[model samples]
Target chain A: MIDEIIGLYNYWVVIFLMMTGFYVVIASTNLVKKIIGLNIFQTSVFILYITMGKVADGTAPILEEGITSYSNPLPHVLILTAIVVGVATTAVGLALVVRIKEAYDTIEEDEIHDQDDSL
Target chain B: MDNLAVIQVLLPLLSAPLCLLFNKARLAWMIAVVVSWAALFVSLSLLVMVNDNGPIIYEQGGWPAPIGIVYHVDILTAFVLLIVTSIAAVVMPYAGKSVEKEIPVSKQPAFFSALLLCMAGLLGIVSTGDAFNVFVFLEISSLATYALLSQGKDRRSLTSTFQYLIMGTIGGTFILIGIGLIYMKTGTLNMADLADRLPAVFDSRTVHASFAFLTVGICLKLALFPLHLWLPNAYTYAPSVVTIFVAATSTKVAVYMLLRFSFTVFGVDLVFAKLPLTEVLLPLAIVGILVGSLAAIKQSNIKRMLAYSSVAQIGYMILGISFVSASGLTGGILHLFNHAIIKAALFMALGAVAYQIGSTHIDALKGLAKKMPWTFAGFAIGGLSIIGVPLTAGFVSKWYLVLAAIEKEWWIVVAVLLVGSLLAVIYIWRVVEVAYFQTADDESDIQVKEAPLQLLIPLWILVIANIYFGINTSLTVESASSAATMLLGANS
Candidate 1:
């Protein structure tokens, strides 16, 4: 029982983080907080990919004279690309928040809804 | 010549940055027009090549598949490529005049650049064989769409853009997770490789979870029914040109993604037989059709009404898929093409109205037929297509859908299809009545003039296409059935 729990703990943590990030995105009213939630969710997915690539006693994916064991490098490269995409999304999200603040004088979702409704 | 598929995507991508170098709006518009038409020409040739020679597979950087990215040009990809590039071509000429009036001169060049980038991203999504590459291009198109939406004149567009940004990012992240899970199980990201390896592990819990994630994630992106909260507002407030392009292409590409994954990657037995996905999809699609048409009937603004109508049309595509027959898949794919042309024409006509009267409220369309006869004729024909009137492209797809349902003895589904078309009739007649029967209110002093020749030319192009494709069923029907056979034949 203990062995099974320990073996799958990384995925459990990934699920926990994913659920929390998803919850924050749904529950929060603040636009910046929603963006932060999105980042957390994406980072957790990155971790999920990286965790799956791990090998027992594996070192960094580098070539050497004697070393034969290496963690998978493809997922790492994919995550690097994903991180760049995540950063671009964040930058655009923040720029949009700035525009929203200028247009409506508030960044809270409910407040924005109220204002739009009044219009 | 062998790298023509690569050039189809590369042409638009490379032109985007070049558009940024131009300061004059006219120069930028000209660049966008020329590049988009070139892309269309390339797409048409690719379609012909695939039709005659079968599928063409091009490897990136001279690397083979399962190691590096590959551009797989199958019949489905070629067909969607034609739809997307053709819409981009038709919309660009209209975009020049629409943007000139709506957006400031300084912002026009960047707007065109963003549009080209969006087009490149969409074409890339349809062409690439790598699973992760879809997510990357999905984000590229999404971010560009957000920028395009923010260019709307109404301040409310800022909020709508933000809403779509949040939802779209969540969708993208979910897709990434799904891809990671699939990679974990099979150790491959190439879709063809994954299809080969997945069947051995089809019964695993992880595989099932991954399928769920991918379905939900793609459902969000395609604005399927209940998850479609961001679409009406995004379409309603966006500048008409942006609405026309995205309305015609974005969700349609997402539907193609769903088809690719469900039939090609997951296999029919796993998605349709081993699981109860079709059961869930059918009911939701029925509700989406009924509710979308009902909501569209109540909307006072013309753009919002059309946006709601798009939600319902997506439901028709989903309904066709859930039937899980060769004829049904053909119906779905045909709808993908037919809807693109029909909606593009409808939105362009509405755009012409907005250009002339500066609003898309049904009231603004009052007596519009008297002033803009060509534009209203386009709208009236497009509206008939939406209602699935005989001898229109819309009827072609709906006929296949109804036949598929009847073949399966799904009597209730047939009823839903007929009722949905009837609802479409009511909403379309509402607009036609306002445009033709009612007189314009004399107080506003709005000039009664026709749209410019630039907008009219493209608008009629799509309107003519709707009629031409409806009359000639050889191209759409043959390609759709072949694509369906290819997708289903892979599984059996």
Candidate 2:
């Protein structure tokens, strides 16, 4: 039971952080905070993918001598791309938040909603 | 074949930068028009190739799959390409005058560039057979869409864009997680390879979780029923031309993504016979249909009404899928293309209305029938199509849907389909009455002339297509039925 528990620790961490980020995104009212929460939620998946690529006693996937075992590198590449996507999303979100601040003078979701409703 | 499929996606990407370079609105518009129409031409030739030669697989960089990305061009790919590119082709020329009036001169270049990038992203998503590639292209389109929508003049659009970004990012991440899970199981991101390897692990819990994630993520992107909160405001506050383009293409591509994941990659039995997706999909579709139609009737803004109606129309497509038969899938797929044109025409007509009076509110449409008779006439025809009146393209799919429902002895679904059509008629007629019967208060001196020829031409073209496709159902019927059979054929 302890072995099983320790063996899958990464997955448990993944689920915990994923849920926490999701909750923060859902529970928070500030636009910037929501974005940060989203980034956290996204990074959890990066961990999930990286965990899948890991192998016991594996080294980086490179051809330099007689290393018999190598980690799977494809998931790492995919996460690299996904990380770029996350950054782009963050950049766009921040840019939009900046414009929202300019337009409404408030970055809180409730305040923005109230302004729109009043209109 | 001179590597046409890659060129179809690459053309738009290459052309987007050219728009930014031109810096002149007319020049940028011209570049957009030519590139979009060329993309359509590529789709046309591809459709012919796909029809005659069967599915063509082109490996990117001449490296075979499991190493390099590959594009698989089948009838389904061609059909989606036709819907997306044809709409872009029509909307691009229409954007010239419309963009000139709505956007500042300095922004027009970036506006066209982003539009082209969105088109490229959509084309890349549809054309590629790689699973991870879909997520990448999905983001490309989505980020551009946020930019396009935020360009709406209303400050409220900023809030709408922000909300859409949050929801859209979540959806994209869900899909990524789903893909990652499947990759963990299969060790390959090629869709065909995944499909081959997936059945071996169908009983795995991770695989099941992946399917659930994919469904919800795709549902969010397609704005399926309870997950569609971001659609109304996004459509309402978006600039008129932006609304026309995104409404016609983006959601339809998401629907195509749903079909690809459920049918091609996962197999029909896995989605329908083994799992209870139909149980979940059917009720949601029915509720979505009824609720969307009801909400549309209550909207004072015409654009928002059409946006709600689009939600209803998506329900119809999902309803067809829930039946889980070839004819049902055919009806659903046919609606994919038919709704693309129908909503594009209706939204284009509304764009013209907005251009003239600067408002899409019901009050602004008073006496439009006499003054902007051409625009109103187009709206009426498009409305009839949405209502599924006979001799319109909408009727063709509804007829097939009703037939499929009867085949299953699903009497309630049949009733729901008819009632949905009736609700469509009520909502459309509400607008018809306002546009035709109510006079633009005689004291006011607003001479509401017809929209510019650029706008009227595209609007009428789509209106006429609704009639033509309704009368001659051969193309939509043939492609949709074959696409359905191909999808189900994967099961056996």
Candidate 3:
């Protein structure tokens, strides 16, 4: 039951973070804030993948002599790639935000849309 | 021939980095053009090989399926490969002048590099058999796409790129989750293995949730009507070359994935019978068709109008799938090629107009036919294609769809298809009227001239392909029929 609770606990956290990140993205109007929300959303996914890597009473995926068991390594490797993608996306998003600030003088979504409309 | 398969994708993937090493814009462009043409040729050969031999199952690193990575070069993959390579091949020359005019000279290398990367990613997505490989290639293409779109000088492009980034991440995450769920249940990522394993686990709520999540995510990426809010702005604000590339191929690739997941992975019975996806999708596609067309009629910007029309066209593809007939799926699959040519030509013509003229706003196109006859003529042909007029590729797709609908006794859907075509006529006619008939307002002192040979060459290539394929649809129809059969799986 304790182990089951822990397993359930991990899933709950992933779901909570995912929902929170999605909420922030939808509710926030500031483009930068939305990017941050996006980061949180993607980070939650990284956590989910990492959690999947864990095996009960198992060591790291790298095999060593005398090791009876090891956790699944595929999710860990996939998450590493996902993290790289996340960082690249964030960097690109931030660069676009900087450009948006320079061009429109505002990074807020509503203001930019209003400005675009006026144009 | 099979060895050529892996190298086809790798050639452009390698060229992207090589192009980045170049400082000269012209040299970089020349390299991109050569690489893309080579990629197109390889893709064509693969299509022909697949046509003759059915599906070519290439085990990457010489490892068989249910164990090692695989690249399944079936009829459907070959068909999509052709669409993607064809677009890349045509878009390169147009990219040279379009990029020069819209983007600064210093940024051209990065722009072309991102373009090549996007192409490689799309090819990778289509060719790979590993489910996780799909996600990896998706990121490669999507990351490049964000950078490409942000190159647009318009301020809203930044915001549009940001919006797409957020949504794209969400979609990608959901797909990853779906893949993870399947992996947890089945312990394999190979598609054929998953297909076998999935049916046993189909009754499980976790697997069902994964299927739902994956479909929603891919459809969102495909810009399925209601989830398509990120599209119009992204298309309208993206640099002309980027717009052409994305409008032509991106969503179609996503649609490909959707069909892949639904038919190949999940199985049609599970997806359509158990989940009622067709019931849900059929109505939604109808809604999207009406909504997208109506919205397009209202847009003043030519690019935005085309973008919305794209949303409607996607609905038609989905609508075709909803019928569950071989002909229906063939219509959808064939439209995947036909619409790519139509939209690419349409956008290339628009890019040509935007190149010589300042803007793409419909009102600004006064007497453009008198000024740039070839460009307008191309636009007019593309317009007819979009409206499903006879002797254009679009007519063949709608004809197949209507035949399927009539066979299925879906009279209403057949009527809606016609209505959608009429709406396309309305929007296309609006632009034609402005371009041909409207007298110039005084501020239009810009010297109107036909687009340069470089731009005209690529633009007309697609325009001619649109009509040529309409007449000689043997290759398209045969490939599409085989693809539809494959999409429905071995037993439909």
Candidate 4:
């Protein structure tokens, strides 16, 4: 039981972060906070990918004469692409929030809807 | 040696940045029109090539498969390519007039650029054979979509766009996580390789979880019933031309993803025999059909009403998929193509109305048939197609769907199919009733003219194609059935 606990530590952290991010995304009323929550959620997935790439006592993937062990680099490279996508999403999300603030005069979801309802 | 498949994706992608280079909307729109037509030519050639040759696998940058990204253009890919490129070709020309009226001169170029980017992203998704690459292209298209949808003159567009962004990003991330889990097990991101390796680990918990993630995520993207909350508002609030382009293509691409992952990558046995897909998936589809049509009937806004109908149309495709038979799958894919044509034309007509009358509320459309005869005629014909009237494109799809259900002796599904068509008739009739039967308030003096010829030409083009394809079933039926046969191959 103890071995299992230690062996799957990365997964436990992923689940925790993922749930926290999702909760904030669902629970938050502020649009900016929601985008932040999305960032956190995406970050958890990045960690999950990096976790999959890890190997015990493995060095960074590089060609060398003496190094016999290295972490799998594919997942890390894939995560790099994902990181770019996540960044683009956040940029767009924040830009929209900025416009929402300009147009609605509030970043709160309830306020935005209330204003719209009045219209 | 052939570069047709890559060029099919690259034209819009390369031209997107070029669109940004121009400060003038006319220049950007011109570039878009040229590139979109070139894309259509490229895709038409691809369909022709795929028909003659079985499948063309184009390795990216001359790198071999399972190592580098390759585009696997089979009959299915060609069919989707045809749907997407043809829609863009028509919509891009229509945009010249619509964009000028709706958008300010300064922002118009950005709108055109974003539309091209969105098109390229969708084409990229359809062309790539790598699992991870799908997520990248999905985000590219989605980001561009939020930007496009938020361009509505109404402030509510911003809020709807925010809602869509939140939902779409979550969906894309779920797909990412699913792909990650599958990669953890198989150590490959190439779809063809994943399919080959998946059967060995069919019972693994990770595989099951991955499948679940992918399905829920795609359902959100495809707006499948309960997951469809984001769609109607997004479609309703987007600018007219944006609505026409997105309403026609985005969900169709998402459906393509569902088909690709479930059949091509996961295989039918894994989706049907191994997993409890039929029970859960089938009910959502049937409910989507009935509820979508019913909800469409309740809507007062024409755009929102059609948006709900799109939800139901998506259901028909999913319902066909749930059958897990060749005819069933054929019906599903055929509906995918036919719906793109039918819905594009329908949305295009609404776009023309929006262009003239400035809104699409049922009350606003009172006697609009008299003022805008040609445009309303287009909507009326497209409406008939949506209702599955004989000699329209919709009938061919519904015919196949009902036949497939009957072949399974799934009498309940067949009944639902007929009931769904009847419901469509009620909602479509509501629009025709308001447009043709009712008159505007006596003092209001409805002064709206027919939409500009720019809009009518493309609208009529799609409307004519709808009736033509309905009559000439050889092209769509042959390709769709062949594609279905390929997806269901060796499953027995």
Q: Which residue pairs collide in model 2, if any?
A: none
DockQ of each candidate, alpha-carbon based: 0.72, 0.75, 0.65, 0.72
Task: Compute the interface RMSD for candidate 1.
Answer: 1.6
Whichever of 2 and 4 has more DockQ, that candidate is: 2
Considering DockQ, which of the candidate structures 3 and 4 is the better prediction for this target?
Answer: 4
| Model no. 2, DockQ | 0.75
Stretches of candidate 2 off by over 4 Å are none
Model 2: per-residue Cα lDDT over B203-272, one tens digit each:
9999999999999999999999999899999999998999999999999999999999999999988878
Best by lDDT: 2
The TM-score obtained by model 1 is: 0.98
DockQ of 1: 0.72
| TM-score list, all predictions | 0.98, 0.99, 0.97, 0.98
What fraction of the native alpha-carbon contacts across the interface, defined at 8 angstroms, is recovered by model 2? Answer: 0.78
Extract clashing residue pairs from model 3: none
Candidate 1's C-alpha runs over 4 A off are: none
Candidate topping DockQ: 2
Candidate rank order under DockQ: 2, 4, 1, 3
lDDT of 3 at B63: 84
